[model samples]
Target: MPKFAANLSMMFNEVPFPQRFAAAAAAGFKGVEFLFPYDHTPAEVAGWLRENQLENALFNMPPGDWAAGERGIAALPGREEEFRAGVARAIEYAQALGTKRLHMMAGLVPAGADADSYRATYLANLRFAARECGLHGISVLLEPINGRDMPGYFLQTQAQAHALREECGEPNVKVQMDFYHAQIMEGDLAMKFKRWFSDIGHVQIASVPARNEPDDGEVNYPYLFRLLDEQGYDGWIGCEYRPRGRTEDGLAWLAAYNQ
Candidate 1:
């Protein structure tokens, strides 16, 4: 069976963060991922994970003004210092929390910003971050968001993420294959999975059309899960979906799967 992790940010919004950790453990998940744990002290987060016997599968680096339309500026010109500081802080937090994967949010580009300049800046920042993370034994992942969900985001396709990884030429940096965004930006989920499996460091999922539970929408998850098994993907598949109803109530499909 694929190792499963609950995306506490999306899956257990109805519960408090610490409580979400406990709930995920009770739900039979081996690991958990969250947006950011910066609000709480790293020691506190680490304690919670150890108490629950759950792994921190992934977490985001600081996203400066991501909600205010500033989007990611990790690769934006003149923001190199800010990006480096963010990566350093993220590495510190990951080390404290015993996290192995850090998702680097490549911020949004300003209108008419030179694409070449932004790409160059991004590559430089990635090289530095990857080298630093390598020393700490942590892998940094780049995620591509869907334009429909997050307009003006800098990276929005697997192809772009793959290219950036190639350009960076760093073994510690890889793509975070979010199935929800990939399904929206490009179809052929299984084939894409096969093609980019080597470059991928982590995977997240939610059903299409509704962004709800895996069984609530168009994506055939059973088939997809089977495909993942066939491909020998041993990484955590995060349950990163919003609950249309009570969180536990929405998880009925998982019980059915178990049965």
Candidate 2:
């Protein structure tokens, strides 16, 4: 069976952020992950993880002004100071929550922005983030988000992520493989998983074409789970999907998998 972490942001919407910790624990998830935890103090978030006996699996760094249509500022020109500062804040939260990995989103490329400029800023930011996070024994993961869900999202393919990681040359930089995104972009799931296994640090799952529970998607999750197990991918598979029904009710797939 595959070990899954409830994506608190998407899964436990029945309650508020603070309460979702207990909700996930009750749902048989040993770990939990979310997009961001900045609204709550790290200490407050840590208390939730500790009291619920859950592993703080993953989270993203402070993306600038998320409400202002800013997904992240790491690749935005002239935001280097803010990007580095955000990394520090994220590291504090990771330490407090006992999380081992933090994801860095590459914000949209500004229209008319120089392509080379975007890549340079992005790689530089990733290098700094990876090095800083490394000091605290945390890995920095770069996730290639599909443009369909996030139009203009900077990183949109696994190969792009790998290329950036290599360019940054940071030992702590690794890939956060989301099967949903991979399927959307370039999917040969089993083969790609094996090919990129060494560069991958985390995994996430959702159905293809319609980001729903794994049971109803084009993906055969049972076989995928078996593939991961056989390949020894010992990382959390974050359940990041929109539920077809009430989130709990839609978890029959997980239940059947004995998660």
Candidate 3:
């Protein structure tokens, strides 16, 4: 069976951030993931995971100036120093949380920006992150967010991500495949998963167009779940979707899957 991890950032909003650990555990989740855990100290976050007996599935490295509309700095020129500092801080949290996967967001592209410059910076930054993370036995991840949801985002396609990964030539650097974005940008979900199975570090799901529970998605998650089991994907499948109602109440699909 494929292991599922609750995305604390999106799910279990009825409770406080710290309390969501227990909420996820009580809802039958053995692992959990979130966008960023920088709001709380590593010790505090680790304590909650220990208390709830939940494994930390994955989390993102700090995206630069989130409130000011910056998505990430990994691809932005002149932010190399800031990006490296973020990587170190992320490793600190990963060690405390016992997390093995870290997603690195490629920052948004400026209007009339030089693609070559951004690509060069992104590859260099990814190589740096891969080296830093490899020493600690952690894998760095690159995700392709659809343009519709995140306009001007530096990364936007699976092919592009894979090409960049190949160019970086780092074994520990892998792709974070979110099915929601995949379905939007590239509809051949099953084939794509199979094609890139070797380089995929993490998986996530949500309904296409609506970005809700996977139960009603355009893509058939049930079949995909079976495929993951058959393919022997021994990785956590992150539930990174917003609930239609109460997070727990909207988990009928999870209950059904477990049954």
How high is each candidate's TM-score? Answer: 0.96, 0.97, 0.99
lDDT of 3 at 198: 90
Global Cα lDDT for candidate 3: 0.95
- Which candidate wins on TM-score? 3
Question: Per-residue lDDT tens digits of candidate 1, residues 1-259?
Answer: 6677899988777778878889888877779999989889889999989999999999998888756766666778898888889888998899998999999888877788899898888889889889989999999899999989887788999999998899889998989998889999997889999998887899888989789888857778888888888888888888888989888887777875454
Q: On residues 1-259, what C-alpha lDDT tens digit does candidate 2 reach at each position? A: 5789999999879789999999989878899999999999999999999999999889999889898899888788899999988999999999899999999988998677798898889988888898889999999999999888888889999988988888888888899999999988888878888988999999999988888888876888889999999999888999999888788888777786662
C-alpha RMSD between model 2 and the true structure: 1.1
Ranking by lDDT: 3, 2, 1
Which model, 2 or 3, shows the larger TM-score? 3
* Best candidate, lDDT: 3
Report each candidate's C-alpha RMSD, comma-separated, in the order given. 1.4, 1.1, 0.7
**Model 2, 39: alpha-carbon shift in Å?**
0.6
Candidate 1's C-alpha runs over 4 A off are 256-259
